[model samples]
Target: MKTRAITGFFFVVVMLGSFFAGAAVYSIFFGLLAIVCLQEFYGLLKKSGSSPNVATGLINGAYTYAAFAALFHWDVYPEAQTIHKLVFLLVPAMLAVFVQELYRNTDKPFQNIAYTFLGIIFTIVPFSFFHALGFVTNTGFSAHIPMGFLLMLWANDTGAYLVGRQFGRAKLFERHSPKKTWEGFIGGIIISAIAGYVLSIYFKELEWKQWVSMAIIISVIGTLGDLVESMFKRSINVKDSGGILPGHGGLLDRFDGLLLAAPMVFTYLYFIFN
Candidate 1:
């Protein structure tokens, strides 16, 4: 428990620092995080007796970097314009995997290659939305948005845990996640709403309605993200992705909620404000 607390503290500090540091810094940090997470993801697949090659790993890592770069570099190039380039680049990258698998003549090569590709797209692609959101400028207002999202998410998770421990009676989703309860889920939503109200005062750019809307989205979607990761772990019969962090499990586990929440938040911001 002590180790978990210490590690969680350090993780929170670094995460908070990076978040406040601006788009460029956050992009770099999240980019590296995506790479490490992809690596860990492939490792998990391998441990499950699925073979993902080094070449596949490198290509997937490159894909993740490219996605973030495209989103962050939106000022220099339009998103639609860069997306065309992404599709062009991905063709050969994916083909290389099939070509390698065919050359090696491995059993179930196509299945392995497909799964590797899916893992990269599913796990890392959504995070690019975060980079996109960071780059969307409302001057000083943009700076506060990511922090607001983080605080709301953290509050939801923390509130759920505390409430669930104290007064959880009815299970939320027993098969996917046994510990989660309906009471805790409602508590998380309440806490997130409060955090959103508090942040709206300082954000200035967003109205109270927008802030509340965002908070509700984050709480619900973030919980879905956590449940998704829980499902993944259950499918593989593992308790954690990796023991890289004492209590957090793996990079994937730590960021799973963010991964799921980011895209949804980004979409909301874009549609509502843009």
Candidate 2:
């Protein structure tokens, strides 16, 4: 518990720092995070006897993330226009994996290629949407939505963990996650709503109702995201994704909720802002 708490503290600090620092730091930090998570995911696949083209996949992942980052900054930075043009090359870069696989002479060439791209789709695409969330509005980069999103997510996680441990009786999903309970799920929503109410007092970007709505979205959908990731790990018969974090499992374990929830929250904010 001590290790987990200490690691969680630093994780929150670095995450909040990334948000407050500026767009460059935020972009770079998450860009690297996406790459690292992608690598971890590919590593998991390889352990399952599936050969993923790690080199091509990482290069394409990096290129894809950089392109998306540049596109997100198109409004604020002029040079972003040039960097944004790199997005057009994304298709060719992805296809290069297929060509590279052909020479490997492996029988499962398509399977290899599929998993290679799957890594990018599973990891990079959501992160790209997350990166876009920081630039959702035309006015400028605002951390209110993204930061609030994290606050509510953390709130739900805390609430569920505490409440589920105490009052949880009915299992939420016994197959993927046995500890989760319907009671905990409801508890998470309530606590996250309270967190939203508090956030409205400080961040005036969204109305209180909107804030609470986002909280519900995060609580419900983020839980689903957690379940999905759990399912993935269970399929592979692994206890944790990796041991990168001492108490925490891996990058994927830490950010699993964000994987699915980021895109949904970004869509919500995009419509609200635009």
> lDDT of each model, Cα atoms only?
0.78, 0.90
Per-residue CA lDDT of candidate 2, range 1-274, in tens?
A: 9999999899889999999998889889999999999999999998888999999999999999998888767777876557667789988998899899878977799999999999999899988888887888667788777888889999999999999999999999999999999999999999999999999999888899999998998999999999998998889888788888889989988888888889998888889987
lDDT of 1 by residue, 1-274 (tens): 9988999999889988988776667778877777777777787777878887655756766675675566455554444554636646766776777777877656888778877776777566766676566655534225578778888888899899999999999999999999999999999999998999999998876888888888899989999999998897788788888888887788888888887888999888887766
- For every candidate in turn, the CA RMSD to the true structure comes to 2.9, 1.2
TM values, all candidates: 0.89, 0.97
Q: In TM-score terms, which candidate is top?
A: 2
Q: What is the TM-score (0 to 1) of candidate 2?
A: 0.97
Q: What is candidate 1's TM-score against the reference? A: 0.89
Residue pairs clashing in model 1 are none
Residue 23 CA error for candidate 2 (Å)? 0.5
